[model samples]
Target chain A: MKANLTIISILAILFSSCYKDKGNYDYAALNKLEIKDKNGVINISIIFGDTLRLSPEITQTTAQNEENLTFEWMVFDNSPASSYALPKTVIATTRNLAVQITEPPFVLSQNYRLTYKVTDKRTGVSSFLFYNLTIINKYAQGWIFLEDKGGAGDFSMLLPNGTVEYNVYSSLNSAAPMSKPVKLEITPFQITDDMSPSSKKIYLLTETDGMEVSYQTMQKKFNYGFLFYAAPQIIKPTRHTWVSTSTSATLSGSLGVVVNDGKVHTNLVGGFPGSKKWGASLLSPAGNLNYITAPFVAGGTTYTAAVYDVLNKRFYSVGNTVLSAFPSTASTVFDMNNVGMDLLYLDSANVVREYNAVFKDETNTPYLLKFKTVSTTGAPNLTLLKTQMNAPDIVNMTAAASSTLTPHIYYGVGNKLYRYETTSNTTFPQFTFPAGETVTKLKFSRQPLGTSQLAAVTWTGTESKVYFFDVSNVGDFTTYTNVYSGFARIVDLGYKVP
Target chain B: MRSYIYYFLLLTAILAACGKDNRVMYKEDPRIYFSKFATNPDSTDYSFGVKPVGLLTDTAYLTFRIMGTAVDKDREIKVTIADSSKAKAGYHYNLGPLVMPANAYEVRVPVYLYRKPGLKDSIVTIDFTIEESKDFKPGYNDKPGLNVYDRLHYKISLNDQLLKPASWDSRLALSFGVYSKTKFNFMIVTTGKTDWNSTIFPGDQNFLIQTVKLSLYNYEQANGPMLDENGVRVVFP
Candidate 1:
């Protein structure tokens, strides 16, 4: 019996080995598939209104039946970046064997996942191929509102969509190289000019750095900063401006820099970091609290800019030859941040003043103590424009976007929104928000199609909302088109120049 | 033996029937909410509470309810008043010292409203949210939805308006008047209807109502409604 058991064991082992060993495995028989055109980074740069078409060749093993299969192509935001864009749900899907592209958010470049899932209907076997689609920006030309997300700010791109797109920066620049969520408190961004497409493109000014974005492509641009891949060198300047004629790359723009380095200097041409080279030109004598007043050119060459020493409360003009007291004000220029040569200051009685360069009669300022064109006192002709009871505690002046009507320049005075009409040289009440609402920031945006509208950000202790009033006609002041909202206590606002 | 088995079976059935899903059914979790889900308050959607005017010592409870397994020790929950809320912290009213005792389901926040006599128009609102605290989490709402919605917070609208704004249109709500509390309530409640609301778009039906608020108030007074409703105070033109 023992001998029989041994023989039987040997025989069983031989049979099992024979059953397990089915000769050399054939690689061709395995279910295998490959995406033929899946080479290089999956990023595709597409111009606005341009159609994108791609059909990848799927190669499968001859032994695997590839004739009957199911396919699903989907696109969704796959960014784990909270500092950047909004909630990205599935924007598009296709069941065809090929990939068909659709209209992307034109405000900024969107990070999308183009997926191809192929399933063998007969065997229930499936394979998936994913390509990261970087839709390079194409049309960011409009009012780009920014959200000061404390540490990591959020951006909204209102395309010339007649109004604006909310929180567009996250979508526009989140995936670009050198992209990072902020690690510090971010103030509201600033733009130094009225953007003109051919002459100016919007350049957002930040405390830490600067960013230049394409108006047509909406694709954000970066430059060779002090740190090639980190913050721009333009950080920490108390204030900066483009001294050049226009901000367009085609235009040569000089930069005005006022730093606490105890000096007032100007940099080479261009408003944004990309065009602003690593250089500086002194504008004032050192050791003074130099505050650079914006340049004012009365529609001609030889514009004038002044430097105010807050410590001494004096003004000195910056010219092609020398930095001296502006031909108008010697030592009487009040430290001022202007609204188009119009200074906003609280008088001794704390009355809000929108002091513009108006032709005030002999009644005010006894004559022209100091000022530019229009009067003996180019000094701001400030009138008590806001005295509303429910007006919020004014934070400060934000941007001055023009009105559609003859009157331009909007002020976010607490809860009350005031408009200054250069036509009448008068500031009138534009919109008086219901009580409890505070206008945090106001800006004027010039849409690509030419809509001179003023946008305002209002905070309701509980929420932040945006409103746009068509300034084309003063009679339409009461009603406004609330454009977009859901922002942090707004820090600042600016309209895209071009 | 058969009778004994019957008794055992009956006892088992009774226990099964009596067993409760003691787990509090929270709308969302890790956070406390201001709602009527588990509370015993009258379902007035008192989400918008209206207190009578001229009541000097009037106090309304902004009861916030939370559902989950109640804790064993009294826990303190911190609530934050959004920076957007214009209400004063101490002068107008006082908040906090909010407590959800062990084995408790909700916390009733006491808001003592102040009223100065002869004030014809007044609308004050208190907007507060449950700040993330060690005691509890704010909320976790992964519910699939649309059109159907729910809130775990409260906004007390103290007013003397003849008709509380029921319109979902922000412009129409604003047209009612300058009552801060009322307008605030209208803005927060009818967010989707306001074009400024980033959350609602494309499908929001109440958006069209804003045109009325935008029309030059004088123009509306001159031309009435641009789209007249035969006789209805021209909803908005």
Candidate 2:
């Protein structure tokens, strides 16, 4: 019995070895049988190269019944360090012998690969195959930047790498560049200019070499002081302080600088000090302080003040009303109700209207008379005139016609700067440059020379230059050309110039 | 021999009676399905909450009962908010496996996932009112594009116009939170509908899931001070 057991063990081993011993029967026979191996099977194919179709090519072996034999599938990653089999569900069909992979779709801008394999169930045989697969993603054009100067920031720039740089230009000087660049990191860059003051393209560029260039569109200019803002400060060259009369003053509203005791303080005149404080009230009626372009008293009847509620700070005036000076503010000074109350000096009949209220004349034309009512019906009969005179060529009056007060009209008729008096329809003043250089800024001046008679004006004639003028005297005030040359433009006055 | 024969006949008769009844029976009551789930009240959907972001102390009991004869007691709740088709999907709530106890009773548990940066969906209520949590931090940046979507309940102010200063990037941030029937706490942070939020770091007690978008100076025209007409909208999970 022992001999028989040993002989049987050897025979069994011999039988197992004989199966493989056929000197490797035609690889064709293995392919003919259905594979049913406990180990897995894997099939690989090029799913889409020439035409979106998986082309399976068996390279290592030739099969006699390749078409009749069913290929059980499995897969292994050639690149991975450890051997990995495809999820059991990976199956291949006879139709194009395509390998199907089941998995979630690939994410955008991501990479992934799926391997397919197959094996024959009838014969305990299997084969391995694989192909590399990858996915690509699309890009987007993301962001842009814009510039603002008015209420908005100075210059908004969108960089190539999707960052925004904001540059605040100090002034519109051709020589000065904006302040330091503030870098803002962002994607899909974009910007807006609505924050800018003027609705125009404003830019400041500094080349690699640091050369700077600034540009702005030109418009009519005015002298601030010579206009209606000058009043009440006329001390007439006090013995203590040197009377440095100005030949030019800017008309840039009353928000400029006030020099006090050698230190600059904001007068807060007409309101906002431009100090970057949020919600600063300028010329608030609640504050009991109102401001207007021109304030004057004419006739014996001290006509009401054409006070502009500067707090609104709008180009167009809305609730502009005229009222008498409440002794609480302006002191009891001139007898404004009398005809001697020269509110404005007209170049034509030399007449002045004291209370230029909102009104229409006999011709139903809106005129800046002492007491008149303006109708809000049809277009108001108001026209833009040149030269302050009653009769001059009518240019286009861009503002609303129904406005009864004299519009602050500015125009350059040759070298002279003329401002129309709304209250005194016929009279307007001229800002004459004593020298032949280009005019720079028009701003309102603080501390009028002769509170009752003079208005200040400032202009630029040359580089590092300044000129000041006082147009208070009654003569041909237009003839004072040499006064501006001698007067210095109040150096370091802290006035914001355009 | 006669005595043994008598005993066998008795045993046969008893076995015969038992064969008549095929169905199995039990004296105990069947388990009924209970709908109430756990709630984390302190865990808000707000990204940057008035309080710190972390595990919430306030909790509500969550219990369920099965009323059928079957022994099956497994339960799962799907929590998700509506999302844009383009954005990848995220999980809102998932309550793992729980075995029903012999007796029916309520259970209170703490909320874990406090906040994230996705939209909020219905079903999960943080408190009484179903509101999107505030989770965005406001700041300025330069990327000019749409940012992430938030899923907390929040009220939008339509009257305020979106205004970005020129020459400077806008600074914006946002935060929010969500409630979970399964998980105790959930939250998300997103770019608030308005472009007024920036990215925030981890350490400073933040549980709002959110994302940030940047741009140079978009909200208005190129040269004047004005705001755009784009309105604010919130996404829900």
Candidate 3:
């Protein structure tokens, strides 16, 4: 009887639990959203100044129409993590995104986080999709030519892929037309305190003034007056160069040397990024004012910059602030402190620590002075090779360029280019331009491995042309690789190194 | 079962140990002392000689810092001149009223220094000490083991003389030629700047050099040739 009662109680409990308890519960399907790029790609790349257009396919499971959803697109800088917050910009509020990219190009391809958000208005639920966007600089790596369009200055670029861009400066900066172009330089290092990713600067020097512009966008940063802590009263900027020094095994910096009105001034570059303005004129070893005639400096180890003093008619090596003359040891080669000839051109040679300078005596006899500014022991090793050049037309040379891989110096006279060998004292004709054309500028590409390429510019009465030649190992013009025409007088050409 | 109960109690104790701490920190006594003037504490003395370029007076700020938490109300700080001070309070210098503003951790007390005629020949010094005030007491002293005299006491010396600037040798000599009292005075008169240091930007230095050159040329045209104190004609490079 007890077993029967237990079994009946268990059956009663099971039946009671099985009875349906009706409650106010409702069933509804959730609106699922799926978003993807039209091509199923999550990474996109576009050049600066180009239009970025993206169309994404959206799918919703519910019956709600696309009109019931709101879309938003945002772009944020996806650079490496920093102490400061990155910037975010809302691009569009529509389903499709089509916007012009106006951001500054970095030294490297800049990454940007592109987010697309869709919201269901009825349910107030948001769905987000992210994409990796890359922005490349259009004028990132190219050959930049500063030319004189009529009287105003403009810039032209020849991309590595044989694309030519003309009027680049005027097209970007219409309001501020550059003056008569004199020189163009690129400092491929951090110079200012802003710590920008694209810290490289393009220095555009005119006849009467100069200005620093962005290497990527060609936008003006500051004028020549601001380049100095105290600008000279007479602003006749001739040239600018950089001297890099490694203070420690891991720490390095550069000094920007500018020759203005025959005076040399220096400003710190790299190392601790800050507003380093050019200070007073560098003094001579005797603690007196001196004038530098050469626009270019032959810089070597430990900030040793060899410059020619027109006033003293000597070669002085500049170290940070002052100029020190070479040792007065009498040598059969030549006297460094008494190189009584006028300096025609000065640049580093193809050999390490060797500088090649072209000078002319009172009789207009052209001579080549090759000397190492410092020896391996950091002492003055002045004389290397001093001989009279066999090339007679070198006195009329208008433009000159040298390479670190050859012992020959290339110079231009009128429409003819000649190569003078330092070892044999020989002259050879390299190339010739069209009739009535004069070579305006010649520069060997300073890129580390691309030094074999030489860029030569020639100007006729009304138009200019630039020619690129592949130089042989023996300093001979092997091939005419490329030529660009329909340009104004190109005063200077520089490579925007990557 | 007993082991299970023990393990449960151990887990509960470990979780309780992770609770947020509510204990308060110990506070130090509210005190004040004269702070070191420069970033380097070893640089204790603060002295500046007035250049002989018509600068009649100058002001120097003596900074003071607090030791305790900041309060909302302004606090009074007592500053007294030591007996070894050679500068007369009324004639040579006048110490301004000392008060730390509400919630301020540091205060800069201004002391006005006069370029009296006697300073042209001799330098006068003033030693300052922080004393006990109504709201705060003196801080870090020169105890046997304590290294706080640079913060507890300060001294200032003033003078008026024509001294050669340090940068004249390295930088200014190239633009302005050699150093001379007459040339330096001419520079001061032309540029209206008594302080010519390395901080002066190159642009401003060039502008000043040009201005002085022009002024010297005009002065020579008006009053024959401008001569130095030694009766030598002043020239610029």
Scoring each candidate complex against the real one, what DockQ results?
A: 0.01, 0.02, 0.08
Top lDDT model: 3
Which digits, one per residue and each the tens of the lDDT, describe model 1 over residues A382-494?
22232211212222443334333343446665677765544444556767877888776665544336555667778888667778776554424667865565666555555
Model 3 residue runs over 4 Å out of place are A1-136, A189-198, A246-253, A268-275, A284-292, A330-332, A376-379, A446-451, B1-22, B37-55, B141-149, B162-237
The digit string of per-residue lDDT tens for model 1 on B1-237 reads 655565576568657878777787645454676554422222222221333333555556766656576768987777777666555666555664688877888777677755533223555566666667887777533222321223444555444443334433553333333333434343444332322322322112122222223232334457643332233342222
- Candidate 3 lDDT (Cα, 0 to 1): 0.75
RMSD of each: 25.2, 30.6, 10.1
Residues A1-498 of candidate 3 have per-residue lDDT tens digits of 555565576568657988887976897887888888878889876777788888888899985569889999987778543323766778899989988887442223567888999988888888888998767677777888899887799999998899999998989788888999888977755454233443567789988999888654577878888877667778888877666554344323366677888767766544442456675566666544545656867766633567788777787776545567776652237888788989999887987667889999889999998887555444445688888899969999999997777888889999999888889999889888878999988888644555478889998888889999888777777557888998888988888855
Q: Please, what are the lDDT tens digits per residue for candidate 2 over residues B137-173?
A: 1212212233222212111111111223111133211
Model 1, docking class: incorrect
Candidate 2 — which residues are off by over 4 angstroms?
A: A1-412, A428-435, A438-440, A446-466, A471-498, B1-122, B125-237
Chain A: TM-score in each model: 0.49, 0.21, 0.75
Best by TM-score: 3
